[model samples]
Target chain A: MWLSRVDWEKIIKHLSILALVEADTARIESLARDLEKIVEMFNKIVELNIPEIVEPLYTTFFGEINLEEDVEWESMGIRELDPTGERLEDGYVKSPKTL
Target chain B: MLPPQCTQFSSISIKTLRERVREDSDFLFKYVEEVYRAIERYEQRLRAYITLRPISEVIDDIENLVKHGKLGPLGGALVAVKDNISTKGIRTTCGSKMLENYVPPYDATAVSRIKNSGGVVIGKTNMDEFAMGSTTENSAFYPTLNPWDYGRVPGGSSGGSAVAVAACEATVSLGSDTGGSIRLPAAYTGIVGLKPTYGLVSRYGLVAYGSSLDQIGPMGRCVEDVAIVLNVISGHDPRDSTSLRVNVENFEKYVVDYPLKRYRVVVLEEMVSEGIDEKVMKIFNSTLDVLAKRDVTVEFRKMPLLHYSLPTYYIIAMAEASSNLARFDGLRYGTRSEAEGKLWVDAYRKTRMTGFGEEVKRRILLGTYVLSEGLYEGYYLKAAKVRRLLHQEFTKLFREYDAALSPTSPTLPPRLGEAIVDPIKLYSLDINTVPINLAGLPAISVPGGFAEGLPVGIQIFGPPLSEGFLLNIAKLIESGRSG
Candidate 1:
């Protein structure tokens, strides 16, 4: 495996606390095993004898992105994401811990 | 009266349906009624929809639609949307527990185009949760059953959209293909699905899963129908920076019954070599045999990098998914379980932990791990570089041949609960389909034939902006199979 158990545990812990999602400790052992298998499958990709300097290609073509003038337009009109509008405070959608 | 083709077994062409509606206004109402009746008959068995519009609501909308004069090509067509594509005021759950109650305030660019072209959205179809798994069994609500065999799964994450069209639940449907999501389902259900060139359609409102690879495309009973819907949805949208600026139009005209005189195409040698199920290989070979009898020039060529595409696709997709799905932290939209703590950070952690499913979480964890500081260089970077080599390889191949051919899925639809248990098994099903997405090319999967009494799909992939060309290529296979 590319990652050792200690490495896996350390990464998962850091990720759950800092990154986009959190993991339930109960599911971690199984998820770690699943990740190991997936890594075993995908790790082969890094092994291809490609040139050391091949650039990472993103899109097929560089799309011509003409940024439209920064003009005022109608927004999504969402003041409170809560459908019933009950989560508002002081004319703003309140964060759970704020106020 | 509706066209004779508008019978129970087959659907009418978009153009024919439009003309019929023009001649007899009431014709559309009756046709739509029949569609609803068909849905009522089959939806219970198929579980194709996560949210079907009530018959009364659809009727009222159709009534208003009829009062307006000029109908676009898709006039009065009943459209089923895959749940991943946002429909205004419609719950876009992405077939996950996470956003089960989340309704979008706007329609995806493709959905809006369908409405503007006079297509009526009948419902949001079920899908794999956040388009992660191959079988809709990954869906939180229920696994969608194949109309061909109730014991088997319809291919996913666009499984329900494909079944909706196959079983006469909707006139046509829009499904987002990221890997084989659209095509595999279409193949399994014996329908037609196209994954347009990556940037041809806007992804403005599509819930992102592998943003680079995800494409919103059309699914139908025929190539021309899929092409017509493609016409409506394709073109530049300033909203998506990646949306191609090129003006490509009138895709339906390309799907013609013409001879493929001197038309050259190639089959991936690896496609038929290994990993393909024996029954599916037999069907694919026969499908190619029928083409061999034609004036077209076909050859078997090896594109070595294709074998690596499945892994490359999974790595890239999981990375993008982790980043895109991060927004679903339940603060602003989607599900919010009661906060277990006062800290916003804890609430955020709880929301994501509670919201995402096992498959979703697994991918997220893997994605996050690979994208982390040291690992990104080794795993993600290597995949991206390899992706470039794969892209260049296809570009070189396309220069020699007009298109490439492969079976849409390696195997026939597995029995329910069969593939869902094994993630590698599910991921392997996308081997033939993911390469096209990695290259940002167009592909159409047509109903090739039956294998083991189940449908097999043959995909024709082409160069970027070659959607029209690919559709015509698919037409050759489709007509040959049927006629």
Candidate 2:
């Protein structure tokens, strides 16, 4: 099963055994080599599974919206957080005359 | 007769006829041939200047002013530039080893303004290295001793400017304020310091420390002198994009036509709450009492945003400073290392190690850590979020009050070396003044009275674009001397 494949306790036990070893020169060097391999594996997981983190955030913030090309950074003022936890005025506004 | 009362030398009260004549071409050539000899006798001993304009150039300009019969507002008044400001063809050390030999190719906007107004560029005054310390003791070069005590601090960063004004070295001097640099020294030295609205004066020629927080302001013996200097420097400049677009009125107009009855001054309750020494608080209250006696209507109020000001200020300023100062990599400018057979990394590290002081290095390291990839979201970005909230709170407070008031410093000048080792205590010296800088509002520190014979200052913070109102309120304190 997918749940059984997770093996959280097995990973925790392996890390604990590594930590229990005395930090002698040999042990430290071996730990460093293992850490590098672990980091590479973690990077691969992140790269392959990026859609799981990014897609949800994009949909939530955009909500079926499109960006305006005419907008410029200099025209915007400070965007504040309102009570509803939304970015309140995007720092820039349409000129009053234009409105 | 003489030039208008405003332009006359004796009427101005700060300049000697001899000093004024340094800007007098007829006096330099036709009367006093050796002007540098005269300047040395009049202005040199105060240690008011770190660098000077050439006497040859001064003589030529003085000749022109006298020739065209051009009597500028400061026509003959001598002025000192704070060392942090770059002056074309002259070294602007900012009282540090880093810029000890760095001369600029063009004048700071303020310097150019003074020259155009026919004001003499007397010299650059001493300051804290990079305007980092409050006591001017942080100067890598030399500390500017207070003219009042000589044993005590002259206030810092802008200490040289404040001392120059208090000792009458220059009628008016320019000082830059990041976190109370102008006002604290002005208070300690018994001079007037004005930190104009953040964008009122251009920052084009200033060496950057914290671009969002630092502002150049005028320091003088009195309010009117500051007004005179501000008028010459306050107009919008195309060179500084941050400079305001609105027309700046003659600041003198505000002082002269002060409507004390129409305005309400709100004293900050937070300033008087705790840790404010008894004597200092007493003097500050007496100032309020005196204003009330004169029917000036003083109301005691508290600013909630100000409570979190000091910590928020440090996080933001240090983060910005760390980034701004990264340019001092011993490349292109400043002190370079002499380590032999050095790798590029070793040379870079060696140069920074030798050139910067402990406090500077600490801030830089903290800034680097906060800005690093992993920590930016937690520290730097969070601090900026807090800063935006503080600015909103300030805007709300200004909507109800004309200006907020507080003691310039929580305590009188601490004895030399008293809290020197404790960097946190030194950073807290800016407790009362930092919020104004964070909000980018204009504020002033006027001498309120004394605590144990040392001067104390009361601050007035005005809304953005309201320097005129801030100075006008400060005048009432300057005149009464009630405390």
Candidate 3:
């Protein structure tokens, strides 16, 4: 067996919600107040792990990619493959959602 | 004390029960009365049930089925459902006070499947608060008794479903296995149970335990009857996100072609060692002897990652369970007492304290601990890494062999009170079956033989979506008269 039975009652009582609120309410409230700060710190830790080179990589190759560079390619009259078979039809080209 | 043997009804199979109804129009009316009487007699002792509806309603459903000229494949079959599965009008308690009064407005995918196929839902079976514990003893209402011996556990959290099947209260029952909830109970009480592969069957309305590990399966006296029920219930349903988009086929068709003769099987020698009872090992070895005679090649293989499976599974499952079960506060649905004057923060605390069972609270607390600050990486994240390793090991092994076989549980069902003091011992009951859950593969527990006069089971595990092949191989072993 992986889990052993314990005196759960004893553990539950000390950690009971009533006791926590009554006794250490301020500390509990402060801990609750600091939750956002904790989340912010964790976010910072995640951001700190990002490689510096990735920022330039994201800006240069990704941002500067020109959609108009393929004007001649677009004019080749190569029809895109319609997966739903509607692009080949007369006047009614079916968007995925419409289907 | 244990309930007396069922009177007015005793030792009836699904076929015979259907035949009785067909031969005499009034037969099922009498059987319904007997079911009511039986409910009155033993419902208290077994606590195997949460509610028993009026027999008149059941008769109405049967009459409607007949009026429509619809003869169901499971005609007149009575089944006890594990409370986790939704039934439209019945209160689905999931063995916790959380949803004590929450009646589902619609049926679960499986429940609807059963009703359409001519099966009647007799009652909501007890489970481990939220299908968490190995012993049904953890149930909030009352623990289900083992029909073979009440003093012993029926094996849970599907204990009520297994006991209801074993005691002949119902012809068959459905159980969900997150970690051996189905197979372990089948082994504990002599019966056939299957945990079909992930997404093979819809999980649309099953109360979530561990989303990835949970699978709904059938329990019955023989493999064929289980297959019959599986054919009806196992299919695509758009309601569940994970439900497979595949054609449903009769599982019995797979057995007809004699596929067992050509397939290769591997038995994990290391897994069957140490923790296994001596008597169980004897029967398991004899079962292997039967297979050897049939020219079904059986060889012992070792998978080292299986050693770490238990810890990996518990960490991941509880972590998921804690998050899933958080929906059970008093406000949404279920038994909720007034924490009125207290703020909403304290209200969640008090409602959960009184409403949830000890085992439920334990898992929630443990889950909270595992996912808490500074420990999530060490516990939950590490377990996920180990689970990937376990899956990788099985994937590598499956490439070489069609399926792997092992003793479903290391020991036969322990007497009810023997291990309650030791939760770890009870949790370890899932040792063999957990690996299958962890790998997200398919497995079944067929009646292997007897260990110390109690039932033992042989578990057949295969690659994902191989329920057809797994059942065929299990049928071969189950029907082995040569042994």
Candidate 4:
């Protein structure tokens, strides 16, 4: 009953697009079965009724972030950015076209 | 006086090695050589390291450090680092092919501190890819086997770090725990691992798994060794916004000198009500007997909120992982697809699909789903609310009790291929551990005893920044012997 509503194919498709990553299409059904089992395990808490005053806690610490002053710091050295040098072409990385 | 060519690094605690190294530099050199000899002997069988520093380079770095008179408390102490914690110029792979060749540009704050304190990083240990799986079997490179029983797995994503210490490959190691990654491996291999309170150790260079839950911690062959390493690593760093704005005392002193009178502790009944293997349960009961014998008070309560931890943990961790891993589009760092001319979007897709392992991709898939349009409130937000409640529950409990105890893993280390067969089966193994992470508390797994000739671990949990007390408690338990 916990897994009655899962449409893993549709979800995985939507997810792959959203994440810009794809699972192997060859046996996506098996992957779907596996995900469903994990979700079924997760559904144990899905129907949890929370008190309204409880805010969703995110970070563990409660202090203000220690921000450094707004001054221009030195840029990362070229070596640190591109250690292998194979990606850099005249100080910029060459990549596929956006279009 | 050193043992011949094959020195057992596990036998040499960090405190012992530090005192000896301070007196004689020749002893230090001989010891480092001995550590590598063990690595050469057992590394092929165990596969604990993904990238080992060439011995020549390690020796040269040590010589240079000694020459400059900059060796600190960990001077000449060899360390193994979980591959995810960036070490500048070292190939820091999070046990994924995506980062197979990725060298870090800088050290994680923890690694930087280790080096500053005279700890020498021997190599980067293997882990579950991006610290995802409960077993290191999910590693893209290979699985790290247990030192106690080679047929069994070393629980992960800190499996390699645990194995490195257990097999005498390194004196101590650093590992990151999001949902019990550090403690599970330490439990499986019969060593000590501490998952410090969230924000107790900086995560500036640790590749994010679950930003809120992830904390870098230490592992060692003994309790005092872990405490010694903890002293070197724990402190605030401005680079990590979550880093606790607090001071840390030397944890070693607590282990050595803390007067262990009767301390109050409890075990939650609901946590072990089901799913524990029979052998594991026997070992846990015996450990409690050992604790009782030490004059420590032990009680049980049905912390019903703990029943929801596994489900809540998976939802929150996967959601955070989905967001945190978005940067790995292969345009900036890590490996890229070799497919020639394609659109940028296509490039991102191809690179990600080819590079990541099955476990990593599956988490990204589920993570993306919970954070998607209408379902976000139903899944991610709900889990967060439950998490808040769990955190409050622990906070209330700690007011009366010094710590809570549990069997670190519900079952002993499964055979290499047995656990990864079912996703839920593997995820269930984290029930005792994930709640501590969700609550943002410190916990340590110390060697409990053997169950059927295999190692077991007893996990001890403490409130936020209670690492020193936890170590003292661990030392107390560590000093006690099994019947």
Candidate 5:
């Protein structure tokens, strides 16, 4: 079934996704079409007749997760922590006014 | 004047390059120049690199290696790294506008390992934006064309790395495989790409796609060259928590003078039966004949769960991607929104909308949808259960067989602009390779043969951590092709 624009809008809002919904009509329509195909493809997973007894495999075959000791090491300064490489006046990165 | 041996890039293996460089230090510079000249000729059309280092930088690196007497196993070898793998001070765009100008402060663990082993960082190869698509068409900058046929895709998101090695632009390159990114491109470009057992190589610097499925591996013209690079990069790193604590094996040893062992190998009956291009099938059948001639028993086996791998992979991968990519909010080093007088939320919306490509946006939406409330159990959990079943099924098959073989991709490289139009068809191209990643097994795509002028690759996969064994099998086929 083709997703209507209203359905797409609902999905975007439901997911709290602003970027995909805010695109031009053509782009949004194309995305809807693509997502429809993907969703249809994903429908095959529901058809997979997996036995109920099998547990879900979340992780691959890495033997025993090793937890590191809580010893603190040399850390990146505030400047290094920032991806923009802009200097922080305090310890936090300045951003656009949210309020 | 360079020696004939040093001038030939594609024909000479990484093993030979290392030996020649160690014997004569001057050969390294001459070989690098030859690689650069090849790059200059091919880079215009192949578009293999996002960031090509200056010749002076490479020369300085070589000179330093020579002066310090620190030519490691991959000494003087020009290795093209996928742009996603961070290089200290090199722009690792990951084929995204967001990180277009983002120069990494530190080298990825794999990059550092290569440098320590004396491999020169030739350039950062192009890839799909954040490795979100099967075809390199999703790269934010531009799509990479297949070297074999300019009209066709190189098979990505490791397309550039594959093309660099295939077009003789780089001797060997590093690419990360997340659901056939390495192996599929390798198959298309007619090179050897190995996606080692997950955790065999650290993921410290690889931009996360499907974190569970991602692995940085080597791509080369031949299996031995792939093995050589694998040896240098494969090892445990404390930085990557998922890294396995195992001794790094001498993978190259398995390629040379290794006794050919008669082993039972299976071709998935389901994989070979349908959707494969006719010519690709003929090449695959011929590959089986080659293996049979090498004393390896080739048999057909059926696994019904294999059919469900594509959808299962998408669900798990996209779910993980949405979460992993959430860290890329404009606050960090990537491209931020330029809309003035906007709130942070608006900024994020604008930044992501502009920074990501169409395919990436689609995945992020799909990922968010799957992981959303009420949908998680139906989609994400069900796919996970099926994934478990696939892992169990592969484990059962491996007990009886040493390896499972199939055509790496079901079809030849899609003509440029053909695949992107139909997203599902594009995803289905990964049908043969994704199952191996879901099971987290070691798989290699060796240049099986050519079909209709495009290259066809046969995949050889074994149980987890069987990279050495898998490489040996691939080498056997590679050697047969040469001899």
Candidate 6:
């Protein structure tokens, strides 16, 4: 397996995605196995014989995005925004201390 | 006069329902009551809806429309919306505990349009969490059962919408197809599902799964109903930057006066290879025979790159998903963890850990891994290159063929637990449909035939913005079946 040589613990730490660490060992191990299988499947792309000159297709259709004129519009009311956050006090959302 | 009982609902089309409601005052209320009765009967076993609108609310909406005398094309038609699409003041759970109580302050552009066209929002249907899985089993709340057999899955992530239509819980429904979400479920439930050309429909309030790949479309029991819903939900919107500026055609007209002409259709040689269900193959072949008799010439063509679509789709879709899902941190919208003294990052982690399901975490991890340094070039970039190749191949093939036909799914509706055992197998089932999404082309899955008493769907693919052409072909096939 391609992932057999790689250290998953180190990779997880490098990414700083604490979600990976939060997963149980079995879940992480299963993820590794699944990733290896998926990567192996993706390795089949090498067999497609794509020429180096062909540019990658990032966007599906290449049409110029017609940006609307920058105009001010009525924003959502503060009361409307109140319900969508953790806590609403003095028209502000309460959050954990960053420091 | 009232239309009919809930048992006879599937036979009536949205076009007929609209006309009946307009001609008679009491027909609308009767129809709504019958639909609610059907929901009450089927919803317990089917589990199709995540949140059903009260019959009173629907009646109120209809009464207001009648009072104002402003009935649009979808007059008094009951529509089930997939929960992922935002509905103002309604809890739009994307089948995740994360958004369990999150009610949006605005309706999705499609939902707003449906209401404007005199369609009554009946309920929000169940889906795979954040539209991730093939079977509805990945939903955090509960897996929606296929209306055909309660033990089997109604293919997802739009399973509920598909079931709502199939089981006659709603007149029509809306579902978003990122990778065969709508079509797979529609196929499983014996309904018509269209994944419109990317940018054809506005994605303004759709919970972003794969932003570039996701397009919300219609699901119904027949071509006419799907086309009517499509007509109402389509057209460019300024809110969504990617919304196409092209003029929206009256898609329902194609269903009515469908031009009966010889259509050059190509069958993908790769799709019919080994591992396809024998019963599905029988239905697909017979459907081709029906098409041939209708002057739709069928020919087999080899597109070798078609085999790479699944891996390519997952790589791109997951990468986009990881980026899009970052907005669901605890401090923002959605459910927050009870973290008093924990670090902000820990709070985010705790919230996500408790909220997201296993399938969601797997995808997020895989997506993060692919986009990580060093591996990004090896996997993500190469996938993009392959995607371009697949797109080019499809583009070249369309030059000679009017449409490409294939089985919507490799197998029949799986037993509820069958797909959950193997995630990779679930991903592979999307092989036949994802290529169309990759190329941003329009495709529709029509009821091809029955297999072992279950419906099998034949998908028809057309070039970009050729929805009218695609629907006309589907309408012709549907007519050929009944005739």
Residue-level lDDT tens digits of model 1 in B1-483? 111213553366677788888788888888878877777666788899999999888878788777775367888788999999999888999999889988887889999999888889999999999988877888889899998889999999999898888887888999999888998999888899999888899998999999889999999988888998999999899888888898777887888877434678899898777778888888888877777666778888987887788889998999888898889877777777676677777777787888888889888877887898887987899889989999989989999988888888888999998887778888998888899899999899998888667888998888888888788778877878878
Q: Clash pairs of candidate 4?
A: B74-B118
Residue range B1-483, candidate 4, lDDT tens digits: 111222554358776777787788777788888888888888998999999999998888889888888777886688999999999989998999999988887899999999988889999999999999988999999998887778989999899998898888888999999999999999988889999998888899999999999999999878888887888888889898878888788787778434355689989997677888888888788878877877788999888988899989999999999999999988887888854546787888888999998899999999988888887888899899998899889989999899999999999998989989989889988989999999899999998888777788889998888888888878877777522
Candidate 5's residue-wise lDDT over B1-483, tens digit each? Answer: 111222455457777887887687788788877888877777887798999999999999989988998887886788899999999878999999989888888899999999999889989999999987778988988889987789999998899999888888888999999899999999998889999998999999989999999999999888888888999898888888889999988888788534357789998899898788888998888877877787888888788887788899999999998888887767766887775545677777777777877778778888988887877877999999998888889889999989988999989999999987898888888989898889999999998888777888999999988888888888878776666
Candidate 6 C-alpha lDDT tens digits along B1-483: 111223764446787887787688888888887788877776898899999988888899999998997668887788899999999999999999999988888999999999999888899999999999999999999999987778899999999999888888898999999999999998998999999999989999999998879999999888989999999999889888888888899998788534445789999889888578999999899888888777788999898878889888999998888888888876777877775555777778777878888788777777787888777876788889888888889889999988989999999999989978777788987889899888899999999878777888889988888898889889877877777
Give each prediction's DockQ, rounded to 2 decimals.
0.52, 0.02, 0.02, 0.61, 0.49, 0.43
> Which candidate gets the maximum DockQ versus the true structure?
4
Quality of candidate 1 docking, DockQ: 0.52
lDDT scores in order:
0.84, 0.68, 0.73, 0.86, 0.84, 0.84
Clashing residue pairs for model 2: A76-A91, A76-A92, A77-A91, B25-B62, B25-B63
Q: Candidates 1 and 3: which is better by TM-score?
A: 1
- Arranged by TM-score with the best first, the candidates are 4, 6, 1, 5, 3, 2
Candidate 6 CAPRI grade? acceptable
Q: List the residue pairs that clash in candidate 1.
A: none
Candidate 5: where is the Cα deviation over 4 Å? A1-6, A16-22, A77-99, B1-11, B257-259, B340-342
Give the winner by DockQ: 2 or 5.
5
TM-score of 6: 0.94
Candidate 2 local lDDT, A1-99, one digit each (tens): 121222423332333232221122323333334333322322322222122222111000111222235544553223321223243345443221110
What fraction of the reference interface contacts is present in each model, in order?
Answer: 0.55, 0.00, 0.00, 0.71, 0.55, 0.38
Query: lDDT of model 4 at residue B294?
Result: 74
lDDT of 1 at B248: 79
Regions of model 1 farther than 4 Å from truth: A1-11, A75-99, B1-10
Stretch of 10 with least lDDT, candidate 3 chain B:
B1-10
Candidate 6: chain B TM-score against the reference chain B: 0.97
lDDT of 2 at B144: 70
Better of 1 and 4 by TM-score: 4
Candidate 1: docking tier: medium
